[model samples]
Target: MTHEEKRAWIRLIVAVIAYTAYVVVILRRAEGGPLPDVPYAAALLWTIGGAIAAAILAEIGMAIVNPRASRVIDVRDKEIGRFGDYTGQAFVAIGAVAAMLMAVAEWDRFWIANVIYLFFVLSAILGDVTKIILYRRSVPTW
Candidate 1:
């Protein structure tokens, strides 16, 4: 696999795993109480930080495991990246709108924060998936 593809895989895996861990932690804490009442800020922050650390570490490990792996970035790579970013940004916009609406409706901070976090994770996963797919197949030209 190419270096970029490996990076994409790392991102996808890390995002999913981090989000899942956060959900599990939050749910466990909510077993006997309201979800909003659960202590989620620490868990959310930790998971986000952990995901970033894990992805960086994984990339470093990959480089160590295959020192000869090509790290070249071609025009196709750039195009595929742009495509993935554009594809993923939709979720971010949606999340922002949702959060704004929630805030206007006077929803709990927990719900608004979680929605934003969820969309961020989804954006990463979708972007990574798109990059991987384009790498495996072809990137459409405009």
Candidate 2:
């Protein structure tokens, strides 16, 4: 796989793992009782931070493991990136719209914030998945 492909795999794996961990923690915290208010801000922040740190660490580890892998960014890479970005951007817009509606509806801040965070994570995962798929297949012509 290319360096970019590896990065996509790393992002997809890391995002899923980190998000799963966050969800598990929240679920565990709510066990044996009513779904208590989730401490969403700190949890979301930490999960985002941890996902970033983990991705960086994974990339570093991959570099060390394959010291001779060419980390080159070529035309195909750029094309795949652009395609993925465009594919994933819709989720961000949806998230923003959802948050705005929630605000107008006077939903709790926690719900609004978590919805935004969920959409962002969805965006990243979907983007990376798109990149991976494009890498596997030929880029479609317009």
Could you say which candidate leads in lDDT? 1
Q: Determine the backbone clash count of candidate 1.
A: 0
- lDDT (10s digit) by residue, model 1, range 1-142: 7888889999999999999999999999899788989988999999999999999999999999999989999898898888999999999999999999999999999999999999998889889999999999998766
Instruction: Using TM-score, give the best candidate's number.
Output: 1
Pairs with steric clashes in candidate 1? none
Name the lDDT value of residue 17 in candidate 2: 94
Runs off by more than 4 Å, candidate 1:
none
Q: Tens-digit lDDT track for model 2 on 44-99?
A: 78998999999999999999999999988999999999999898899999999999
Error of 2 at 88 (Å): 0.8
